[model samples]
Target: MSRTETAARVPTLATVLDVIRERVTVSRVELAEATGLTAATITHAIRELIDVGFVHEVGTAASSGGTPRRLLELEPTACYTVGIQLDRFTATGVVVDLAGHIVARSSMAGAQEGEPAEVLRFVADHVNDLLATAAVPKSKVLGVGLATYGPQDRTAGVLLTAQPTASWLEYPLTETLSEALGVPVLIENDATAAAIGEEGLGGARSSFATVYMAGGIGAGVVLGGQPYRGATSNGVELGHISIDAFGPACSCGNRGCVENIAGPTAVVLKANTIPGLADRLRLRGDTVADFERIARAATSGDPDALSILEESAAVLGTATVSLVNLFDVARVVIAGAAFATAGPLYRDAAQAAVDRAAFMRFAHPVVVELSDHVSDAAAIGGAVAVLRRSFEARTARSGAPAGR
Candidate 1:
C-alpha cells in the first residue's frame, strides 16, 4: 500500500470490535461488507483477534452460495476481570470473562462497623477466591473494577461521605486493592458503573444515550455513548434530585430528595405503616429481599401494597422524566438489587412519565426497560469495566514499543 493509503487507514479494529460486541455473531465476509473494508483487510483483523484470543472460530454458518463459512465470534474466556459491587448490606464479587459473562460469583456480609482496611481485606480475599475458582491465569486477568455507593472520590478511588459507614471516609480503595491483588483497580459510583454496564451489555447498546436507573430510585447517566460524570465524578445522583421541597430530609441533607421518597427503604418504610400490607407481606426484614417482596405483591394487585409503590414510583418517575429532558436519552434501564422484585411496574410507570413529561416528546419515545439479569448486573458490569480498559490499553499499545 502507498504511504497515503496507509495514513488514511486508521486503526479502526477497535471500532470493528465494538460493532461485533453490539451485534450477534457474523463471519469475515459479512464483517468486511459491514465495515466497507476489503475481504483481505477483514481477514487480517479477524486473524489478529484470533491470535490475541479475543475472537474464536465458533462453528460454520449456512452458505448462501458456494460453501459454508466458519463463524468468528468473541472468545468470552480470552481474559477475565473482577467486579465488585458494595452496598450497605452486602459486598458482592464476580469473575467475568471477555464477553461479560459471569464465570463465578460469591457474596459476604457487608461492612457494618469496622476499619476500611479490614472491610477491604475481606473483599480482596473474596475476589482472590473467585479468581482461583475461575482458573483464569493472573497474566490474562484484567484489572479490578469497583461499583460502589456514593459519595465517592472517583479520582482518588476513595469512598467519601458514606451513608453511616464512617470507616469509608477518604479510604484509598484502588491503591489498597492494587497492593493486595497486584492488579490495577478502577472505581466508580455504583450508579455510574451500572450505566456503563448497561451501555455495554443492556438495551442501551442499541441507543446512543441511556439513563440507567438503579433499583430503588437512584440513577446514572450515559450521554452520547459516554458516562457523564459532571464536575467532580459525583454526577447523576438521581436519588438526591429534589421531588418535594417540604418533604422529609434525605441522607444527602436535602429535603424531599428523590431517595427520601422513592428508594427501597423509603418504600418499605411506607409499607410497614400500612396495616394490610404489613400483615399480608410480613415485611419485617430490613433487606433487599423484603423490598422485593413488597414490589412483587404490589405488582400482583395487592391494593395496599400497590398504593405504597405507586406513590414512590410517581416521585421516582418525576425525577427520571427530568433526567430524560436534560439528557435526551433514547433508552432507560432499571437494574440493581431492587429489580429482583418490582421491575415491570417501575418500567411502565417511568416510561409513561417520560413520554408525558420529556421535553423531546415529539422526537422519539424514550424506551424504558428492566435489566435482563438483575442478580449480577453490577458485578458483571464491574468485570466489564476491567475487560474494556484492558483491551483498550492493549489495542492502543499494540503498535507502541514495550515499556515506552
Candidate 2:
C-alpha cells in the first residue's frame, strides 16, 4: 500500500500506517511497541487495511519466548509516484514505488530556453513517457512531484521570485502540470526536497543539514528529522548569505553573496579573468560544464584550474562555517549537480574548512560528507515528497491527536 502522505484526521489509520511504513515490516506486537497503540487497535486497523488491499501479511517473525505472529509489509508495487527535477537546461524524471525505490527514470535536454508553458509541456510529455516506460498503470500512480529552484510559495504551489530569472515568479507550476497531466501535482524547492529525500530513505534519523549545489548553491536544514521550512518555504537561503562585503554584486541585489563568489557561475566568471585561460580551456558558456572542465584541469595539474577551485573552495568554506555555527548541527552533507563530477574535491575541501573554521569544532566536531548518491537527488526527492505528503494526509485523516 502507498503510505505516501498521511493526515492526522484519521488517528487509528494514520498511526498504524505510519508505524508499518517506517518499520518496513512489522508484526502486530512490533507495531504495538513502535506506535504505543494497543493490540486491539492494531488488530482492527490491520484487518481494515488488509481488507482494503493496502497491507498484506508476509509470513511470520521469530519470537524470543512466545509464538510467532504474522508479519506485514507494504506492497511496494501497489502504487507509484512520478518525480521530476526541473532545471534550466534539462528535466529528469524518476518513477518510485511505494517503498520509494526508483523503478524507472529518464531525462531530456533543451528545456532551459523555452517559455514557462513550453517547458512544462515538454515535462508533461516526459512524465507520460516515464509512466509508460515503467509499465505502471495510471490507477496505481499516485501523483507527480516536482523539485525546482526555490524561493517558492509551497503552500500555494506557486514559484516565487528567484535568482537568474523572473519568468517563473508567481507561476502556478503545480496547477499547470496537474491540469496537463491529469494527475495530482506537488512542488518543492529542490534543496529542501533533496534533504527530505535524504532523511526519509538515506537512513539517517538524526537532525542534520544538507547543502545542495546545482545551478547555484542552496541549503536545507533538517531538524529533528523534519525539514525546517521557514515562512513561505524559502528558509535556508544559504547561497544568498553574504560572506564578502567587498565582493561582486549578485542578482538578488546583494553584494558578496555566496552565489557571487562560490557558485559555479562565479567560478566560471572568475576563470575568464585568468590570462589566456578561457581560450586554453575552450571555455563554454555553460557555467556548470565549464566548471567541470576546470575541475578536470585542476585534477590534471593545471595551476590556473587548481587555483580557481581553491579560491571557490575557500569562499564556500567560509560560508559553510557560518551555516554550521548558526545551526549548531554536527553533520553537514554536501550535495547536488555540482558534486556529480568533482564530488571528492568538494567533500575534502568542505570537510577541511569546517574542521578548521567552524565554531565549536572540537566540542561538536562537525563532519562533512558527500551525498551518498548524486545526479538525481532532486528528482528522487520530488517523488519522496509526494509519498511524504500522502503520509501526512493519511495522518491528518486518522483524526489522532495532532502529532501524537
Candidate 3:
C-alpha cells in the first residue's frame, strides 16, 4: 500500500493507542512527548481510545508541585490476536493481547505429507479450537497472523516454494484463513515474524537480528526500531546462504547451504552415521523428536550427541559471523524450533565465534543469546503482527520506538 493509504488506515487515534500499548502505562504528557504529538492531540486520541474501551485512566502519577497527572494504560483484555507458526513438523499457535502476553498456546503435528488444502483446513480448525478452548470471546478477537517459512509473497499472503510445504506453492493463505475465520488474516515469513516477536516481548531494546533455526534456517533483521522487510518481505534467506561450494544441495537451489549443514536434519543424518548413536536413541523419523532426544543426550554428557551439537553450532556461528559483518548489528538472537531443544549449545558457539572474530569486535562487541521463546518465537510474532502496524506509525512520528 502507498503512504497515503497507510496514513488513511492509521489515524492519530490509532497511533496514540499504539503509544499507550508500548508504554504499558504513561501520563498524557509522556504520551505526547513519546508520540511527538501535541497535548491536545494526545487528549483527543485518548478520549477516543477510552470511549472504545481500548485505553483507560489507570491512576495519577506523583506530581512535582503541580496537579497530579492522570496516567493512561491499555485495557489489555479488550481484544486478542491469534499467532500461528506452521513448521514442517509441527504447528504452533498462541493468543496474544495488546500488551504482548501469551494468553494461550497450542501445538500439533504439522504432517508435512498432507495435502495443502487439507493441512490448511486443519490449521483453521485448530485456530478455532484454540480460541474456544481458551474461552476468548469471539467479539474480542481482532485477527489471525501466520508465520510460515519463505520464500513467500507476503504482499499477497501467498506461499511460494519453501521448506514447510511443497504442496502449498502459490497457495493463497491469508484469503483462505480469513474466509475460514471471518476476520482479517496476515501472513509473514517465520524468520521476520520471530524477529518482531523478540523485539516486542523479549528483552531487546530495539535494534537487533534474530537467527531462526527450525524446519529450515532463516533470519529476521530489525534496524532503526523497525523490521527491515526486504522487497515483498521475502528479503532474508539466512538458511539458504551457501557455506560450502561443493556441499550438499538445498531446496532453494543452493550448494552447501547452512540448512544442509547445520540444521536438525543434518544433525540427525550425521548422528545416524555415529557409532550406535541412532540405534541407542531409538531414532525415529520425526525430526523434532530426534532433536530433543539428541539434545538431551548431549546435555547428559554423551560425547557423540555433544559432537553433533558442536558441529551444528560451529557452522551456525560461521554464518552468524557473516551476518554481523554485513549488518553491523550489536546484538543477535538465536530463535525458532531448532533452537528450542539445543539453544544453549548454539548460543555458546555463535557467541564465541562472534566475540573472537567478528569484524567489529574492536569497535563494538556483539551479544549472542537464546530467544525468550525458542520454538514459539514465530507463533508469538504472528500474534503481535496484528498490533505492530500501529506501533510502526508511532515510530514513524516520533523517530524512535514508542516506548524507547
Candidate 4:
C-alpha cells in the first residue's frame, strides 16, 4: 500500500498515543499539531485514552495569553507487557509498562541444544519468574513478544531456520508460547524489535536505523515513522551481507559474509588462534562470553585482543557504510549484547566510517551512537512490540486513519 493509504488506516487514537509517548508530555493543541488531527478529534481521543486510564493530565503548559493548555502523559502502570529475546546462547526477559520503562528483568540459559517443547517450557518458566519478580499479575499484561533470529513466517508464527537445531523449523512458536504463558504471544525479528523498542523509549528520531548485535549481526530501518520490513519482514540481514566474495563460505550459503568475518563467533575464533590468548583470557566455548572477554581485553589495552577487535570493528564499519548508503538514515544506533563491552570502539569506527565515506555526509552529518540499554534492547523491544500490536489491533477495530 502507499504511505498515504497506510497512514489513513491507522487509528487516530494509536497515532495520538504514539505522539504523546514520543513527546513525553504534550498538550491537546500540540497533539493535534503533531498528528495533524482536528482539534475536536484530538480532544475526543484524549478523553477516551484518559477514560481508559492509559493517559492522564499532568498539569497545564504555559499559555501565551489565553487559557492554559492541559499537559498529558502516559499512565505507565495502566498496563504491562512481557518481552523475551531468545537466542541460541541467552534468553533475556523483561516486563515493561505502558511508558516503555522496564520494571523487572531476568536472564538465563538460551534454547541451545534443547527440544522444542523443552525450550518452550524453559521460556515459560523464565517469563513466570519475571512477572512474579515484578509483582505484576498475569491479568494486567497485554501479552508477550518474542524476539529471535529469523527467516521465518511471522504470520504463521513459526521459525523457518534451523540454526540452533533442526527441530525448531516450523515449530508453532507463538501458539505454544501463548498456551504456556496463558496470554497472547507475538514473534518479531530481534533487530526489528530493537528498533521498535528504541522508538518507544522516546528519544529517537522518527527515522533511523538500529544495528543490533547479539549472537549475530542484523539491522532494522525505520523510515518516516514506520519500520521498513521488506517483502518477508526479514529485511536488513546485515550479517549475511558479503564483504568479501572470495574469503570464506557462510552458513547462509553465501561467501565472505560480514558475520562470518567479524561477528562474535568470528572474533573469538580469531582470538583463539593467538596461542594462549584464549587461555590467558579464560575463554570458554560460549561465543557470547568469549567475545565479551576479548572485548574487555581490548578495552584493557591487550595488544592481541585490541588487534582482533579493531579488525572486527573495521569490517563492521564497512558494513555500516553500506547500511547508511542503502537506508540514508541520518542516525544509526549500535545496540545489543555484543556491543556491551566494546561499544565505544564500534561506535567510533562506525562514526568515523560514516564521516569519511557516507554518501550524505557532505549534505547531512550521520550520527552513530550506542544504546543505553545495549544488552537488553531486543528484550525491551519485544515488550514494546506487544504494545504496538495492541495499538494496531485497536486501529483495526476502529477503522480510522492514524493521521500522523
Relative to the unseen true structure, what is the Cα RMSD of model 2? 3.8
Compute each candidate's TM-score over C-alphas: 0.83, 0.88, 0.89, 0.94
Can you write out model 1's per-residue Cα lDDT over 1-404, one digit (the tens) per residue?
Answer: 34333322323354356556656588877787776767776776677678788888878998778989877778777778888987675567888776657788887666656677887898888888888898877787778998877778877888787554666788788899889999889887777777777766644653333333343345677664456777887877788888788999776778988887888778878888776777789776655666878878887888888888788778777887888877777788887767667767777788889888888889887888877756566766677767666655654555422110
User: How does each model score on lDDT?
Assistant: 0.72, 0.77, 0.81, 0.87
Error of 1 at 320 (Å): 1.2
Candidate 3 residue-wise lDDT, 1-404, digit = tens: 45544443343555566667677889989987886777776776676567657788878998788799998888888888999998777679998876667888888777477777777789989988898887887789888888988778877888777444466788888898889888778888899989888876744645888999877789999885567786778887888889899999776778999989998889999999988899898899788889888998998899999989999999999999999888899999989887776899899999999998899999998999888799899998888777665434543564421221
Worst 10 residues of 1 by lDDT: 3-12
TM value for model 1? 0.83
Worst 10 residues of 2 by lDDT: 1-10
Candidate 1: lDDT over CA atoms? 0.72
Candidate 1 regions off by >4 Å? Answer: 1-15, 21-29, 32-51, 56-71, 206-216, 276-280, 395-404
Better of 1 and 4 by lDDT: 4
Error (Å) of candidate 1 at residue 342 is 0.5
Q: Where in model 2 is the C-alpha error above 4 Å?
A: 1-25, 28-54, 63-65, 162-166, 401-404
Candidate 3 least-lDDT 10 residues: 395-404
| Candidate 3 error regions (>4 Å) | 1-24, 32-48, 162-166, 389-404
Model 1 pairs in collision = none
Question: For model 1, what is the alpha-carbon lDDT of residue 317?
Answer: 78
**Candidate 4 lDDT, 67-173, residue by residue in tens:** 99999999988999999998887678999988777899877787778878899998998899989999999999999999999887989998998868888999999
State which candidate has the highest TM-score. 4
Clashes of each: 0, 33, 0, 3
Question: What is the lDDT, from 0 to 100, of the residue 236 in candidate 4?
Answer: 97
Best by lDDT: 4
